[model samples]
Target chain A: MTPDKLKTILLVEDDDKLGRQVRSHLTEAGFEVDWLRHGHDALAADPSQYGLIVLDLMLPGTGGMDVLKHYRGQRCDVPVLVLSAKTDAAIKVRALDLGADDYMTKPFWPGELVARVNARLRRPLANAGDSIEIGRLRLDQSARRLFVGEESVDLTRVEFDLLLALARRPGVAVERGWLAEHVLDPERDGTGRTLDVHVSRLRRKLGDRAVCLQTVWGVGYRLEPDA
Target chain B: MRLRPRLALTALLAGIPLIAGSVWARSAIERSNAVDGLTRLVLQRMLDGGRDECSRWPESWPIPSGPGMGPGMGPGMGPGMGGEGMPTWEERQTRMQAMLRGGGGPRAFSHLGPPVEFFAYSADLTSRNRLAPALHEDLRTGLLDGRKVVSRGRSNDSDSPLEIAVRMDWFDEPESPSAIVLARQVGASEFGLAREFLWGVTALVSVMLLTLLLSAGPVVGRARRLTRNVRRSATDQYATSIPVEGSDEISELALAFNAAGAQCRAHTDLLEQRERSLREFVEGTTHDVMLPLTVLQGHLTSLAKTSSGEQAATLRDAIEEAHYMTSLIQNLATTAKLEAEDAPPRRDPVDLVALCERVVARHMPVGREKGVRVEPVLPGDPVVVRGDETLLEQAVSNLVHNAVRYVDRDGRVLVVLSAESGRFSLRVLDDGPGISPDQIGHLTERRWRADDVRARHPSGSGLGLAIAKEVALRHTMELTLGTAPELGGLEADLQGALG
Candidate 1:
């Protein structure tokens, strides 16, 4: 399916102007956008109806962390994208720990916002079967091989781990820390910047398929399936 | 010796001589008078005895006559009396000498003695010729008158002594004449007594004068010394204390002076302490208040950007109101701080050009929106100076903001920075309605707004220039508010620090 064919998104923002702008842009990207003014409103909305949620940390009535706590308390499995003007690292880690799928700071480009939303909607593919397919690209967990339309592609250890993490999720976004913890070994010389170098290296190897990796400024990277 | 002793000695020296002279003169006069009286009485008695002896003779006696007596046949003749039954003239002379020598003749002759020599002279020319011519003439003259003659006479011979002669005529026989002369060696014993008396009086007077001087010397000297010390202490500026060694009025004066000095010092110290505390309080309050204000300004700027239409307009109005209120509070705080004594000035090296540029940047957006141009004339080199950076920045910002707010569309606001003589100066000039002469005086004062100028642009808090002036003063710098000569608008020149 095309990336624009994704449906259902949740936007949580306290600021009236920014929230409205974000909703309009996400709706224009062919996604059903449900907008809420604060953390309390987002928590009250039916979590199952939305595939993804854009949550702001600073919200009147109830703070974003409390909303995240409530969503996790209800065992809601919907993907959550945390949004805020707070750029501190501690705040991002806390949100991600509370089951938020990703985080973004304010003044972010609208295109990046749409991309992040699409990536969150695609997160279910990682748990579906262990084999995932996107256009000519295919990954087989059992074989440990990645093929582009019957032609096998070669990748380094770091590049293979990076591609698997993204290929498993299909269209979901993965934060920088998540990639560093799961794909990159702590004993090795790899870091967050190392992950980016590997991503760029992998994209170079994938060639025309590099459009799948997107940078969501102030947020982390996301993988988007081609339209 | 000291002045007191010297004065006493001088008094004694002058008085002792005068008293001694008076005593000596008095004693000498008394001794001479007593001696003179005794000599006169003794001589009279002697003469009277001689006359009595001559008168006792009977008329029948034959008396030797030379010049006064003629031939006479009488029982009392001169040769008859010369026999052993009566004392002869020589024998009488000897007895009289004995009487005078014994000092037993009379009470009137007390201390007087007999003459040292005696002589008799006859009235006959032949007897008188044998004597000295002066004696002979004196004897002849006395016999011719038949009168007793007493005269002090000196002999022609040097060997002979001074003599007193008593010549008397015999009354029994007129022709018979005789003179008795009694003389004594002139002894200095009587005059010596008078001289001794005078010397004794002089000695006594000198002793008394010395005693008087010695007794009065210390008292006078002490008094004079006290006067001098008091005068010297009064005129002395540094050593205003008189030594209080004794329980006297001078000691009391010293104590009073010391007490006065201590009181003055205490008062001065108290005033200084109070002034210092007041300054500290003002400085601390100003620092605390500025932090909150800056935060508030940042929040407002963010708020203004998010709202739209009337909401945006309302937010802008709120922000402006807040800015005005904050400015007023800042100005009031600064003014109060300045009025405090010994306020600690916030001094640091600051770049004037950079400071002015920052202020211009803060106001430039607004200026551009209003179609007013903000021209910053920054120096090529960093114009560094020592002053309070925050206050300087605020002052420059105030001037720039005011320019942008008041000037007409297309009007220019010029911020010029320059340095000379180790002093950095910043001037903000605008082509707007210049401040009137009357308003300039009140512009720097707290809450004093020019109504005429403010009416044209009521957005300002009217405390910008006041705060600027106060900040300038605190840094020991100058802030002059006037009309720019070239721009024909308000000009604020704040000069501080050295280049």
Candidate 2:
């Protein structure tokens, strides 16, 4: 995708009121949004020009599912966030199975919609090669090491993966369920308590710099760049 | 009293009287034939002139009364006859032997069988021989009536005797009637053929009854099978029907049962179709309501963001009210989904930490606006349990929303998550005034709220905690409420197994 595409979003919604609100919210969140009311218009648009596409499942003239299928058929890898008024799990699962990245139900907060859009737009940090630097801590991806100031801190395999998972999306809170699946060692139990143990130990090792690794309450951990 | 035993009992009850009647008839005919043979023998002997020779041969012989003698004449005219000048036993024996040898024409009693014994008596019973048994009352009455009297002597032993007695007229002198008595010992072999015939009849009757009972087995079994099939079909909502086995009444009953089962199945199908349509309508209405609710929320949010001071606060309350309506609609929908008998709650792994975090985040703005400090003290890692993600999220959200709504301004609402052993627990505690002990039990009751709560938050749906309780029960978790020991407020705690 082009660098400008990261600032652009494609929104396809049929409900006039909800569609206007979503477009305005995205715009107010500093995104360039292309709003379309019909699924056919979404199908005609080049998906590659947009970094994130917010598609509503209910649309006139060829429904949203057809447009989603068409884009996925063309191998358009842009993130698609499905918006629906249906609360049925089967429909949500079907949308996710059809290559939708996220699903948001109706009556959603405008601020929440903006947050989800930005989260999707943030590129996965695995693509960042070699090293990643946030605050005084630097994560060497290849070497599998974390350095706090001049001292190189030692972390276990699970601790490094946990820290790396949070560090990937600096300010965004990662879900503990996702972290438990992706960060914990496959051979271990990977229970919540076990994950908690690793985090506490990692915090102890981080010492004064542990402030950067903030807990997002009921969510998972987040890493903030210290000024 | 099943079919087999009932048939056998009826056969037995009917067979007993028939067997008895047949036995009595056979014995009567046999006795009559024996009496006839004896009568012919005695008459033939008299025709041979043995009675005339024996009558004058000796006075020991019982004879018809002479013309001058009557029934009142003094006894001593024959042996064993009581009189004033009765003869000695030896003398009588000599006279009896002389009379039998002297009898002319044909030897007396030469035609008689050795098994038989005979005696003669005068019409008044005053001239009977010593060997004759005392006359029975029934036999005596029969002889007086001029009918032959035949009887089996009363003896329990096998060698019991049978006697036949009949009145006879001599030389046409009916007034001087004399009777002859004959007796013979009886053995079982005497009626061996009759016994065999009777045994055959009894065997045949028994076989007939047994055959009837045995044939009823399949019918009884079929009836039992129909009963079992009816019960089984009921459990499966009448998906199966009974097999009609015969053209009899049982088969007719089976046909009737099958018809009834078909009707039940049709009714069940109709009910299921109605339920599915109702679910679809509810989901459709929720979706329709959600669209407008979202727009109103968006408008209220923008209005709140643009306004300042008291106006902004009022808009914020409006936004909060809008959010409450959205949640209320969602909760009702979830309750309806849970109540549907066919749809069981999904068992997917849900992270309680993430659930609590999102809930706290959603209510944090309201908490901030209310000056309530909504804090979350979660375990450093995730606390995942097996449940439906949406339901658990909603349950936790309700708990936090209730806490934020009820807690006084500047009060603290603590949402804590912890994992111990293999189980995960969540506690939402607020430092507001705790409920009375009486109200704790009714906290989860649908549409129930305290009087004070109704006055304070009139827009509250009173369904949040109820929904949470239902979600907890469906997931096999325990949701308990009590006073928070440290926080001095209402505490809601939910605990369940790890996913």
Candidate 3:
């Protein structure tokens, strides 16, 4: 791990053993780790001191969901990664709406936890711009404007974000789910249909240069330099 | 052909062949006896008359000189009965008339009502008479044996026209026994009457059979109904037993069937009850077993953090094993639930690409711990299929888990999810020693593992592929196995309907 001087994680877990293990792993990964054994203490903590919060959903004192609500209500901008043992889609959506930045199920690898925490901490600057350009298509970040060879193309919010996510890594494939997570409104169900329609609209907006955004087989979209 | 109607028909039609055959036999015997009786009576009358007329016996009777008639005509025979192999009965009647013309002999055949012709054989049968050589021999033998009774000739009524033969001794001239053969010439009207009588007998027999069948309708119907009841008890699953009406065969059959049905019902009830309890036990046990596995996994995670390098890898392996135990319980519960009549899986649109990714994610850590590479190659677009989401996940997870577990170090396990040929397919291919051809067929059997596989992964439940197969079947999909051409290892493929 390349040392980031400002990195610190507040981990909220109920299990005594799991809490210590996660704290130890995060501490070893060059992040100053603060372990909270109760959801109440996590809900009371100040988010200003931490870059990320790795919270287990099965907390003893305040319940992980309530803790998420508490911090989110207080306008806590710190990323919260909710961990559980199973994929309960309804609960996941609820947690995400309650201000969880990401979801990770239990029994996850230590490397994966660190990666998720790092990814969450590295948000916003991860894109570093409101716009991007690939091939014949260029997106103006500041004005949320798209131009294909100096001509502007109108796009919906989801369409713009979807194209931006793919354009950020021109040749790398973006996951179908990650695209939806970044683009679609967090309050909605965000079924695959909504994502598909957005992609279709975005492609149409790209016009003849739509071929630049090519779908990688067995993966997702990759914005190639040339069609 | 229902059992009842068939049985009734069998009983009614059973006697037709016997009745038809016996009628012909009885008629033949009656005809033969009638011929024998008539011939003997006529011959006896002639012999008695001959004895009485010996005092006035004509030494030389006028022979029929012309072709048909040369002498006096008798009162009975109107004309000569002419055909091959015989002096006509008419000619013989002419001779008898000539003898009786102004002659003083008692008329032997005048008292007889039927018209019959007779010929005498002096010694050898083949010598003088126009009689058939066979008939002549029969008559000669009969005479030497002093047969008082007549014998039937070999010729049937249709062939010789009612022929018979007899031998009698003449008391006045008993030196040489004469063989006499009589051919009775029945009138056309008389023949018609006899035929009418035979036809009447056939009609009467048919009528009798019909009447008997009509009277037995109730009995036959009862037997047939009993047969149907027995069949229904065994096949249609009729609930009630047949009613026993009387101490008869049908009632006895009903009793047997009723007893059999009771035994069958008891057995079925027992089996169903046992299955229900066993399903409950599995569900309860799986739920009870998951808690400890969860805590154990938590402890292992803590241990893995403290440990370094090789020890950490070993801890991760133990954690993976514990995780596998949890999955086994879940699969056992799921299969048990499927076996039960209740708790059917929900049919929903499941995204196969997303599903495969989740399964790959779960097994990636274990693969890393074991030094095998678990790679997921899910399609860019979602591969949607209509099935239970959890079940589809379980199926794919089982495949990916097995791939990671069975593959050698540095081997790659690739999970590919795609929509191909309008079906959603989730394929898990590994790069390891492939399963043998003989072992492929038994891969889906519950807890079945090859000898080498059991030796290699001794702790494996061997139910991973079996659970995958069961889940596939429940989703109305097929789980197929093969050796991947590229990977040179086991490839587990599940193809499901796309929605």
Candidate 4:
């Protein structure tokens, strides 16, 4: 964590009330939120400087879609969450297809928006380095591999994705739904029972180290490395 | 076409030919048969009478005979002759015709009742009485061949043509020139055809009527059933699908109806489920939101009650209301997030020591203002867990706030965090009025079914504990409410595996 390059976000929204509320909420959540009202300003500004972007689709001067298109066309990979009042399912899918990392319908809970932002931000933070370690557990991102102390362990693709999702935010309770989306297919959440099965199998594979996986009943699962 | 009418039409069409055939046969038989019979009788009588008369005549008397006629070679011929003399063939022919013309008995040729006429053909085949013989050539040939011939022709003797025919039979010999012809005028020529047409039409009508009668029952019954079912469905009437009957047009309709009913039922079920869940969410959200709104209203009412003298305190309360508002909104968002099956909550490393410290820090100002000491008893080492960091903070702060609000003005509230036995625990203890015996048992019931708590504590919405329980559940931690043996007050504990 550096002073100049803090975990900051550029938020572009037209609504003053929502803007102030979200800006304050994100600030309280320990992010330096640079609030902007116009899409022109957002587009003119360097998109790569921010760690994340919270964009409202309805914007003045330049439309939000245009800004998104131009920014993504320029290959800016900073995660963007398109926040809008357009609750149509197709619109959300289109935004996602157009490279927006996530879509949140309007009237969203501030904490939920922050949670989604934080989830998206975790990727870069975890992917920034090639490897991560939590006590005896270590992950090698480049090799897509995991190590239990000095003993290298065998893992399936799903196991690796699951361990990676948990290891990236060690000590954090990842929701079962989110874990399923990242570790398995996102569509498999329709029947949540499969997640429980996968988690149990993952814990079995960990054996004596299964303590790292903790069940958060009715919510999801969490990873604790130093258990 | 509908099956009812189509079936009726089919029967009618089938009956037409049958009626026509029967009527034609009866008419032809009645007309031509009588005429043929009379003709044969007359010819036979002429031949036999000529033979008898000739045989009984004296030997000196000359015999006028024709080929194939036996003149007096038979013994029984004596009484049959009009006189014992040979008569001319013409006279004999006249006598035979007179004999046959008399009555309908065996010896009479006119025995064919009414509507019949007699004709005599001499040996040379000349017709008598200006009667035009029907099938003249066939009769002549048949007479020569020793066979009876019958045929039909239309007669114009009356204004309307009568179906008239003749029957002729040769007598005595195959080549005999003597023959008798008979004609009978049946009713109107078209009477039979017209009768046949009438019968066919009648049969067709009856067949159609019968078809309708038969089909009406099932078709109309099924139609009514379908209407009833559709009406019921329209009025939100629910039942199993209408029972399908035999394989017909009606059965297909029923199957289609059943499919529609199933879809409607499924849609209704889905709508009901969605409505129920929405209502639950709204009620829960309202109650939770009301906590802050009530607090704000209380502050407003207090500010309104007091003069400008307590302006500073009122302003502080206002600020407190705003903070509560933000947190209430956050709780709402968290609840909404929990509803989505695909969204994994943001899991970050939660520093329990710092969390407890922060909870103490937030509640300390209010506690100190009330003269209560809010202190953190966190371990020296970093106590961390895996969970949604913001939620954990909110949960711990909620517990601390509960302690601050409930404890006496000068009481002590301890925010405790410790790691032991491969786990970490965060507990908030207060030397305030402890939970009642009844309330303590149900402190962490998963659902918001805490009516007793709301009943006991009217001012508190019990939202704080519910939130703490939710957060603890999210983190897979245990949130327990117990009497602190050391502090002798309510102790709220959240414990989980150490991260």
Candidate 5:
């Protein structure tokens, strides 16, 4: 996969300096990032164009919860990761219940934030059929088919489980602990390093479509829908 | 009556009889002296009149014979005696002897011995007579003067002639000597004057006694009333209060008592106000401290969630510190709230066993990390109590936290909740080094630390048990600390909230 093919993300944050720092980091990581200072601007823009939305809960003009409501209400279905300074469980539950794809308490690591955004954008489209599509990539659950722009690719059982985990919620970061618990056998002591090896093998099988599998530093892998 | 007035009245009343007796004695002495003087005057006047009459009537003139006459005189007399017919000296002498002796009739030559008796009178006055010769001489001198002599003689049987001295002055001047003598005796009436003087003196004394008795009545009555008023005022001032009706001393005393009572009430009110203000100050200060402490605790919890590596370690320490500060502030607030006079417990029915289990679970993580085991012995049936749920939770949490923090890693901490009789008890027992007998004395004091224990461990702000103790007291429950039997560590028991 080439760096130019990486999907763009819109980051809405009230803290100006922290937002710029995060944008620069993501930019340097070979991904285009657009930073919005308030929730209103993020909600006004076409959120469908962006691969992912990273919303800060405490924002001016409109709150993260309100932006989430507006997006979900309109059925835009853009993956959103909520960031907040409130660590209380009730707040996290409320944010999630309000259609926020994921919740993160601050002062969160920039790497973790990027990883979650990547994972959220990579989530596959929901349908009753066996095949799942996220942008140009598709996985046929029954046929065990993987395609990148209409060409089919074969995957092993471990590769399929890994891809399926990432595809279940595209563009949302799946923590190594979650992957290990859901994908690997319990008897296998598969560390995060081992999960990294499996993701690398899966990325090589689908060329150019491999751009969706993004490496978020100091955190687990994320899959982004191709832009 | 008061002592002073009663004393004064007694003195005044007593003075009356003394004054009356003194005055009566004085008057009686004066009357007796006057009587003596009148008697002397009457005797002298009689002697002088008799002598003058005898001398005026040559020898006899038949001496007056009425009640006013001389001693031997009779009612009837001869014509010569009536007319002042100058009878001779011998005849007059014979008539005088007849009058004196009554031996001779009213005729001439009554006795011839009169002349012989007169010749025997030449002897010395005291030598030859049983009676004094001077007295005899005086009687004779009065007869020779043709005066009827009247004296208080010793006896009539005396061998001495009576001498009489008489002057013819009044008889010749047409002033009859008998009339002069009668007038002198009436002027000098001794017995009648004495009797009349005594009657006048008795009347004066009676009047004085009556006056004293009459005046004493009102004076004594007024004094008694004044005394009674004063006594009542004094007693009322001490026991209750008296109305000041007038501007008298008793009224003044009542006013003073009222003023004193007012001052006492004012002082009491001031003291109560001061106490209330002090209590409010304490409550406000503690409440103010608690607000920031709660905010700090929240911030610490947030800090613990975000940090990593050494920063996480530092944040954890900060969180513990904040928690300690919150516990201390909460203890102070609870103490202040409980100390209020009208503090009412917010009681609700709660399951003691569930509460204890929750508290034990809260401390279980810390206990597990320290390798300590928390054993909760709960009743099969719920042990229900009517109490403040939050405060009771705080109480049980403190006990469990204390046990978890103090006991060794391998030690066991047991929490038991049960209902016995009508009381519900929640007890926490630990098997670490039990509190020493000496340390137990200062265990509940805020910030108290045991000397023998390691200082590195979480030395509680020492408010946990204190807060629990206050909560128990507020609920009208009992909280006690003792050594667990087999565990040999501190055991805290919270009992009551029965119904």
Candidate 6:
């Protein structure tokens, strides 16, 4: 099935304004919104009916943790994105440990929230194929090579891994720190600056098509389709 | 200066006078008994001369006048008279006086020791012998009143004479003394007083020291025990108190210490309670504040997305103000948590690599909006350090956020975590107009902003660097500020040991 096709999103939040805005945003993002104001209602509802659950930690009655625990206890595999005003790392870790798929601190942008919801509902990109293409920049995963339009681009192992990591999630900002640890060779100094070097070299090799490989500034790199 | 030595010294000091007084009193008594016995012995010897010698002198003899009693007559008219007729009264008297004065006349009593000599004084207290030794007036008066008198005679040597005078009645005179016998000890005693004094002092000191040791042993022991217990309690974090024993001063000290220890424990408990409540309040305030702020942010985001031109820009500024408020609240909460000074940060192994990532991620949107490029330079593997994760995250977040806030638009900010030479170094570097070297030192001062930023960023509380510095200090790490070597902007470096 197509990822955005008539999926239902369950939103459990206490604050009226915040919950309404989030529901409206999710609706605009082409998802059916089933909003609940209390944690008990969320717990009572069947988690399997929804494609995703947006849980707020501070809820009236049952509490978000309890609901999360209940859902997880039932072995429901739906993705849960925890929204909390408590920015403490321990709580975030706790929610994650309770099978939360994602965590977003409060005072977040509606746009960002919508993006997270969609990203969670999207199919795992690994199943798509061995290759990922964004505009003229294409990556062949099995062959470990990249191509820009009709010409093949030469890439070092580090540069290839960096581009492949970004190309897997086109238009989405990945953290530079994550790219450094995962894409760069562990034996080498895979620091953010080191990752930056690899990205720069990869962009240079992309030549005129380098415009499609975008830097997300405070975030990491993003592969965009060139119009 | 410690308890044992102090007690011993005090014992010695107190023992001195008692020992000296005992020795002095014993010596005085022995001296008096010696003088009395010597007087009796001398008097008995004089009396042992018998009735013939005692009756030789008439009851009230007239004074004898001598025409030639010089040295010439002394040799010719020897004490024996040399077979001549009995010596005249004048010659006999002179010879007797010379002998009594130890002038080497005749030995009237050969049985007595050589130092012994005596002569007679008439009833009127006048010596019949012209050369008799001069008597003290007190002794003479004491003799005339029928009282035996003993006195210590002043002399230039340590061996002073013990002199005595007694009444003698002779020739049927029963009511009054017809003569007085004056005698004195002429030689030192049989034992040297120096040796006696040495023995006395040695004995006294030995007894005193032994007594002091026995008496002060338990006191010192108790004092030592108290000292040890006090130290142990301190090492035990004042969780335990010294036991009180006995009714002595040491016990009093123990009681005082126990009270003080109890007070300290109570204060610690009160402080812990206060800290817990304060942390709760800060957390609650953070939650309450964030709820509204989040709603505000959502509305602003919606507005800015739909608006255009000036309206969009203003909405963007409003969103940034909300973000600044969020960060300020976070810093305030962190500051509140840090106020519990005695509580050590949680010792979980924190990954600096992930930490830098989260910090960069958290600030990414704001950085993108400001056109500032905030990035992380981390190691490939996790660089783990032991600390409280939340505090560490906040510290790093502050560093990155501060760099993003002050750095100009289109500038680059880097959060670099480097592990080299077995050391973990975290640095936040930016490529914008950096603080002057002078201002760098003040950057970490709470609420102190660079003079240049106040005009453009008037709302900046300047608490970011300060909070980061505090977190680093709590973790036993060093937070240093300087110009970035590569980026040429402000570089905040946190150096710590690799976990």
Taken over the whole model, the C-alpha lDDT of each candidate is 0.58, 0.70, 0.63, 0.61, 0.57, 0.70
- Candidates in order, TM-scores: namely 0.33, 0.72, 0.58, 0.36, 0.36, 0.73
* Runs in model 4 lying further than 4 Å from the true structure: A1-6, A133-165, A169-221, A224-227, B1-499
lDDT of 4 by residue, B160-246 (tens): 323222233334444332334434434343454556666766767686678676768777778888788777666764556677788
Name the candidate that leads on TM-score. 6
Task: Write one digit per residue (lDDT tens) for candidate 6, span A1-227.
Answer: 34443278889998899989988877877888999999779978998878889999988789999999999999988889899887676787788778988777776667657767655664344335677767777788888888877678778888887777666555554557667767878777646677777777877888887887777544456676643
The i-RMS of candidate 4 is 13.9
lDDT of 1 by residue, B231-314 (tens): 675465324554555766655655675666556556767886786676567545554454444345445555655778887767
Q: What C-alpha lDDT, on a 0 to 100 scale, does residue A102 get in candidate 1?
A: 66
Tens-digit lDDT track of model 2 for A79-168: 998888776766766776789877677777787677677656664333445777778888898999999987899889889988987776
- For lDDT, the strongest prediction is 2
Best by DockQ, which number? 6
Tens-digit lDDT track for model 2 on B401-469?
A: 888778888988888776767987788888888888878877755442223222434465357887788
| B250 Cα displacement, candidate 4 (Å) | 25
* Model 1 misplaced regions, further than 4 Å: A1-227, B1-254, B257-281, B308-314, B332-348, B361-375, B388-391, B394-398, B401-405, B408-412, B420-425, B438-480, B495-497
lDDT, model 3 = 0.63
Q: What lDDT does candidate 6 reach at residue B270? A: 94
Question: What does candidate 6 score on TM?
Answer: 0.73
Error of 3 at B211 (Å): 6.6
Name the candidate, 1 or 2, with the larger TM-score value: 2
- Candidate 5 runs further than 4 Å off: A1-227, B1-295, B302-316, B342-351, B354-376, B380-405, B408-412, B441-476
C-alpha lDDT of residue A124 in model 6: 48
Model 1 Cα RMSD, Å? 23.3
